[model samples]
Target: MSIPQFDWEACINLMLQAMQGAQLGLLRLLSWLHLARDIDGQPAWPFALRLSGEVLLIDHNVVRALVSALGCLVAALLLLALAVAWRRRRWLLLGLAVALVLLAPWPDQALLTTAATPTSFHTSPERFSAAGIVRGEQLYRQQCIACHGADGRGNTPLGLSLEVAPPNLSSGLLWRRFDGDLYWSLRHGKGGMPAFEASTSPADRWALLDYLKANAAGVGVTDTGSWPRPVALPDMALDCRASTVTRLDQWQGQRIRLVIGGTAPLPSEDPRLQSVLLGGQASGAVGAIACASHEATALRAIAILTGVPEERLAGTELLADRDGWLRARNSSGQWSQQDMLCRSPLASGSPVAQVAQVGGSGLDQLIAAMDEEPVRFIKGGFVH
Candidate 1:
């Protein structure tokens, strides 16, 4: 008799494939489990879709509760079945015990009791008026539908192209977020979601927020207002050259023109020019900073401050006004859409119409031109 040759490599590959398939099967089952209203503790809509990229729709608290409950149920049922089988002292009793174990509903019930915490925001009541919704719907059709879909389900081709698929607006998980938080996020722009502050007015932003909320879970707008308007939006700062922290509010009243930059050697003749253009005199601005610096600490700090993921920091130039509202943003195509900064403000009376890449004489000319306008922001240092 001849010994058969074994294909160990092929067997290993097949086993790996099987394991992967099993994981996918488990994911699909969990996705369905997440769809249950009781488990998530919110209306099921967007997050009700299948799991993607190994992420879970449910939060840690819910997952922990479900696992603990399932563990107890399995243990209890198994013990009861085994005890019955032993007491009966019969093989038929053992079979019945196995059947009872198989029929246990603990896992399903555990999944049902799991809770979810959705995103939240601070918003005003007046923003949810009937007129606001109408304007928001129009804006949705014009600007949002390309990615979010007609049904606000985020099923469009553009949505699929995002690193994180655009979440369904109707999803219970998404609804947990406050309208103000969403508005702020939309204003600053993060990842695939562009900064609409450049294109959408503050009131219109509120309108869109109202529209989305109304559509989600079929909720109606309320007449009472709660959240107060902010005194000033939060300021942002990043470490610049010479170890100084460049706060956006510092340039509040200046004619600043920030550019998406990288490290450049300073001119030996002017040591103050650490890659700065016009040296704060001609431009009436404090020069510039490299967008993607070697300063990881600065980058991380900006991420924490802005609530923007660290991954989106590269190749973005963020601009702001004296009052701390991000006035404009420019980007190089190196990073993903979600990482891009806000575009120029869309307010009709905004100073800058489009984000300009001015330098040298062009920067000097823009600064001189902007000098005619009254300064609305100031962190104080302005050179005569």
Candidate 2:
């Protein structure tokens, strides 16, 4: 058999488009399926991923089917548009509407096939930005949508048939690993993924990543698909009143250890962290604190504010996973668009009397941020 010409940039470009179409189709179907006459507010689209420990992990197949169907619809629409214009020698927007409504069911294989076989495929990654996301979408469909699935959920029949499930590029795991890992993976095709280093060019891989983005659902979800954009800050100043003392009431007696600050694996030399065992000495009631933030300068300030001993602070921040995750130590006082600054730990808190307020956020928005042996803190930046 004759070999088809292989162009890395072009194939990925087409794949991106196909994947994008799948995503759009999924969105449209979900939006349509959930549409209802609202008695008062917008219709509730019940497609949220549950975050309870007891809740079993499950797949949203309805959304997946919608994505697949939408991909077909997008193609069908293009064909209908072409057919209408071919006969009339003019644009026919009506075809788009008719194609959209055709997801009901169909024996019309020819018409459907016409839509499925997209004609305008771009190959060059550079051209993608210039030509537009439509080109990017095409590339995604060509190379990735087969394994990643239209929704980015790694649920396609082909992907599922593989021995190891393709990594959900949408998961936090991606952000945790450096981009080099992904590039290497794409080039090498770890495990079941066939290495395309010989075939898929560098430019195409980068472009595909750009279009793929970091999705939580691993299907065709986008950034906005999961988390709402931070509430647009008011143009003018703003104030938010929050309370850190609220959660502290629960951790009254728990000892807070000190985790130190370090840019690399070893965090010993980090100055801001000293040593103090809160309540360890029967006489002095103080605890250690974790200081990882740039400039442990804040730890000293915390020592003075909290009245914890300079010797009581230890230094080390421990977390099973910290990528794209957050941990809140103090969440009191009011903040505004103007005061969007992170809280000052050393600037406040009293340790001599031993009052602790600590909290953490999980890497996954779904997981509860863990509160382990509370990382103690003196007035100094943070001693572990």
Candidate 3:
């Protein structure tokens, strides 16, 4: 009889599979605890490694419950082994237990002392719609303008009089905090700030946050020439000629060229984009779709995103991606890639190189780049 050879390749494959499973389990646990870093936008390791389709369904709640039950079973088995070791006076088992105890992760006292909001309360129910932002602006004027100032820089006389100065809401601070934490602060108040729980409803507080986010995005771009985070184009009702679609969101799955002032001649029609003229007479223009009676509230919200006053918004042109994300802005002259905000990491080549390669207009190059690398936004944050 011939001697059987060991299946080294099969053994190695099994070991690798086991390691990958362990790593995936650890990642799920971290995500459940809200301790996992946002890796959706990253192009590097672990993030770049995608699981096979077979494992994708592991995210389902039923599968997750099964995994949790398996963990509990393993813990029970460990306890059983410990009891057996003690009862049997097994030196090796006791030694292993001591080693595990030495290597176990322990909570840091310093970190423990610091109070943290519950991880369960991380997301906000607010949708950050145009109407919500408009309401938010009204609330800001009523409740926050006294201390935060009209610019949200916290430079008012009332703000200066406080023992602890109000924080600059226009800065990147708004992007750093979780919505739930901000809501908690608004409800309970902090330091010199007064609580609004009595005066403002939950919906009102959320709307206020939406307004602040919009204001911050505009201010950040104005002050630093860059967006603090990716901003979604506020959704609004639209009057499209010869089209049944009555809302801006209905145009999803297609890119949009939004013209604010409508003073200049419309750009050459491109099959790739839908051009909608804002605040202009609907002359039944062939290439461009004219939206009539441009609602002031919608225009105001958009003006905030452009970092310009409503009166100056006439000449502005904005670009929104297929996903309804506001991508670029041009207030004067022709549009260029330099005007793009929330540029994608996956976009290939420098703007100059792209211009040479495409040999097209600046707007065309920007559209191409946007198609190449789509933006990924999640829960008020960019994946990248």
1-384 in candidate 1: lDDT tens per residue? 999765433333343344335534554564577742321122222232221111112243434443455565676567667776677655665565566456544334322211122212134445234355556768888988899886577888889989988877765433434343476666667568888867877778777875665454232111111101111222233345544545533444433333333343221222221222211222223433331133223343333223344466444444333333333333452222232222221112433333233334433323322332223221100000
Number of the top TM-score candidate: 3
TM-score of 3: 0.66
RMSD of candidate 1 to the true fold? 22.7
Top candidate (lDDT): 3
* Clash statistics: count for each candidate: 15, 75, 2
Local error of candidate 1 at 119, Å? 13
Ranking of all predicted structures according to lDDT, beginning with the best and ending with the worst: 3, 1, 2
CA shift of 227, model 1, Å: 25
Better of 1 and 3 by lDDT: 3
Name the regions of candidate 2 deviating beyond 4 angstroms.
1-136, 214-384
What lDDT tens digits, residue by residue, belong to model 3 across residues 178-225?
Answer: 465577678779889999989998788888888998998888788788
lDDT of 2 at 27: 44
Candidate 1, residue 368: the lDDT equals: 26
Q: Give the TM-score of candidate 1.
A: 0.27
All candidates: TM-score: 0.27, 0.26, 0.66
Candidate 2 has an lDDT of: 0.34
